[model samples]
Target: MELTYLQTFREIVKWGSYTRAAEQLGYAQSSVTTQIQRLEASYGAVLFERYGRTMRLTMAGEALLPYASEMLRLHAESKEVVSKQSAGALTIGTIETLAAFFLPPYLQAYRRDYPEMKVNLQPGNEPFIIEAVKEGTMDVGLILDPPLADPELHTVVVRKEELVIAAHPDHRLGGLAAAQVRDLAGESLILTEEGCTYRAMLLRALKEEGVEHQLSYEFGNLEAIKQCVVYGLGVALLPRIVVEEELRNGRLKAVPFSHPSCEFYTQLIYSRKKWMSAAFRDFIALMRGGRGEASKMHE
Candidate 1:
């Protein structure tokens, strides 16, 4: 069957009227009717049933809807893939933290390695980045651990990041050399939005231990949260890498939790069904190099 006829059928089903579909497609209403007629004739069944001025799908059309939608989607994706390849673009998605601190030098090296390849980076939280990869919105993802039940997605733990509790230099908690997870009770705590994977894990730990604390402030922006902690508003639990500068400059004090240090796993995830392009492979290789190979490298 011709692809254009299937497209015409989709437009008619979407708009519910042949005239409206034709108007949207910039074709005559009679042309839309002819296409539907040709499609029905080829299948030997009526695809639509007239109801007043509108049309509804028949059993045959209903059965074919999913396949037709998938075919149209694949066709659109094919065009996109071709366009990206011709333009030498490689799209990578990750969270704001990594995109800000970790990925810059690596991306620069990637460009140095492949000057012809254009790199496109999209930054979001873990869930958003994972969904982008799954939906083919991104070609590759460097995300924090995504809780995916599907076995088709490959997740490789590139490194372990310690979740550190930080506070202002003169805060009461700063006097304690170390803190147990239970010691945070009755204190003001700053946190990220609930969609953050780390925030979810921290909240789960709090619930499990029944530790009660006042949530003084919450920010979707990590940098803003760090600034709040630095300014002595409240303590916050964040990945060590995120606040390394603050710690080094004595602007923030990191309180270690000994009993059960909340360690988060950072990963490079990509779709199993996706064919990794050459540019993507190069970028991944740069990330997985020896501990001291790159300036941002850490054990």
Candidate 2:
């Protein structure tokens, strides 16, 4: 009956664990359990069932999911309609690379425009961000990926982000006019963890070209991957924006490489069903204006 209980249920589904959801919501595990129990009582249906070590949504839970999302969305809409507030919270789901290197200046300018607005930059992989946008959870999502069209969401290509293969200054492949897939054969590669969009692109391209390379290291953190490349552990595929400073400082070299499959973009996505806020439109406008130039940045 309580909206907060529904919120908890959604959080549980998002996190896939009672304890994890509780931590995310800043509630005790017992409190989360009690809230879920109350939610179940109101519906008179078991929401979750244990499948081995994981808790999975039961048939009833699957049925309630959409209604719960719609109710929460409407609740948010009601507040927006009634208050007509000049400033409020805006959550943007994005990936770590964009959060670290790409979004700060745009966000800073946005803050200057809406100083009272609370901007929550939620970081996740591309797929998770897309799903969160569709679910009405994130106000908008910025993802580095190939251009994709979804009926449930409005997609905008903010910029075509160039992916590059980074190597140390002393590496054998350095100073070449350009590197091709053929050049990658037998080379040791330091890769991002499995889900990275560019990483997948690179692996797929290599597989198609029959290029065999060593997977020397797999790091989730971009900085770690850069550091390893700097030490000559191996070359890595990453966005050009991320390694700009290193390349300028003579630490890393961008192997001249560009392939059709590896081309990704900084894309903006928002649900077609959700009402767009003024702040949301302004943020997208700023992104389209230009990426804050690196030389102008103080950070």
Candidate 3:
């Protein structure tokens, strides 16, 4: 099958509409239809199922998705290699909180030292970031305590971040130096979305301690969570780095919590088999507070 056909198929799957995919690919509607027909005719399997106005992927389409993605990735890499376009270009994936609080200084320092390098930062949940690294779509991933043990990936611990229960200054638990999980039983808890690593840890701690509480609000954005807490909506468990400014400004109070899971590590991770370019190596070294030999080249 042609690469353009595979690309068209992937775009159709992403948009869930043939017309939308055609619009995005700058192809006439008939061309998209003909391409899909040719692709299905060659494979002898139906790729997509049409139900009136809606379209959904068939079993064949589901099976083809991963291979299509891999082929596209390899094609891009080959072009980069042939054109020598990969150097000085780094793509990193990370979680939202780290993108906000932890990465700024290190990124600034790296840019100052290697002004010729180009950095692209993409933020998502832990699994999304890890998958991007594994697929070679991202050069590296910075995540918070990824739970899975993948033999293909190597992880380096960057730092352990302390988690604390944060609330408005007027909250009753605000004055405590440290509080037990059970202490939050009667309180309303503001939480991040389900995929958040720290949120998962916090829930596990409460469950193990037999503390039942109400989830007052669930937010996907860290700033929104902080704002809700500041307005006395609820107490939330958050990384200290995320709340440092609010804590210092007296807008929020971080009460240290008594739990083993209160501390989670930030890790820099990448595929073990992936080639380490000088730029990638230098970035990893910067994150680890080590100046690798690559640093001397740019100097």
Candidate 4:
């Protein structure tokens, strides 16, 4: 099948209509229909089944989806390899805290060094970032304590961040040098929403210690959780980087946890099969402190 035919097929499947796909691809509706017919003729299988006006993918179409995506990706990579332009786009997925506290300087440096390269930063929780990287939608991901058994992705520890239990300055744990994991039992806790890696780690630690606590509030934003903790609403486990200002101002106190797992890591992750462009490589080097000659750009 021709690349254009496969492109039309993919677009049609995505939009679920020849008219819409044709509109998107700047082709006539009849041309879109003809391209799908050619693709179906080549495969000798019905790719889509029509139910009134709505078209859905058949089994054959579902099976062809991944292969079509791979072929398109390979085609783009091959073009990039042969192209003289060294600068391209890089999309990075990260968590909110890292986007706010950790990535600003690094990203600013990258932009200065490669002015022609476009950088897209998408912030979300760990699971969303991980999935984006795995699916090839994101060029890289900065995640926390990634899974060891994910064979499709490669990860390196870029930074070790301290995790601290923070409470209002007047809270009982504020005066202690270190609090036991069991001390959290029955205490009101403000935590990130479910599926957050740090929150999951905290829950796992609590479960391991057989300490059950009240999850008093769940929030998606780190700042909201910090505000809640600062006002004595509840205690929260957070990265030290996110609460440095509060801790310094004495608005919140870091209740050091006795558990050894209180320390966590920020890991740089990407797919193992990804083609590392020069810009992408430099971005990784920047994150790892191997800036080399690129450091001059910051000056």
Q: Residue 24 deviation, candidate 1, in Å?
A: 20
How far out, in Å, is residue 94 in model 1? Answer: 1.2
Instruction: State the weakest 10-residue window (summed lDDT) of model 1.
Output: 290-299
Q: Indicate whether candidate 2 or candidate 3 has the larger TM-score.
A: 2
Poorly placed runs, candidate 1 (over 4 Å): 1-87, 146-150, 258-261, 290-299
* TM-score of each prediction: 0.69, 0.91, 0.82, 0.79
Per-residue lDDT of 260 in model 1? 51
- Worst ten in a row by lDDT for model 4: 290-299
lDDT of 2 by residue, 72-98 (tens): 998987786676555778889999899
* Rank list by lDDT: 2, 3, 4, 1
Candidate 4 wrong stretches, greater than 4 Å: 1-58, 146-149, 291-299
| Model 3, residue pairs in steric clash | none
Mark the 10 consecutive residues where model 3 has the least summed lDDT. 290-299
The lDDT of model 1 is: 0.77
Q: How high is the lDDT of residue 136 in model 4?
A: 71
lDDT of 4 by residue, 1-299 (tens): 79998888877876788889999899999998888898999999999999789788999999998788778778878887887546777889988888998889998999899888888888877878887787676889887763333778877667677778899999888888888888888899999988787788778988987887898999999899999998899999888889999989889999766676656778888888889877777787888789543221110
Residue 51, model 3, lDDT: 67
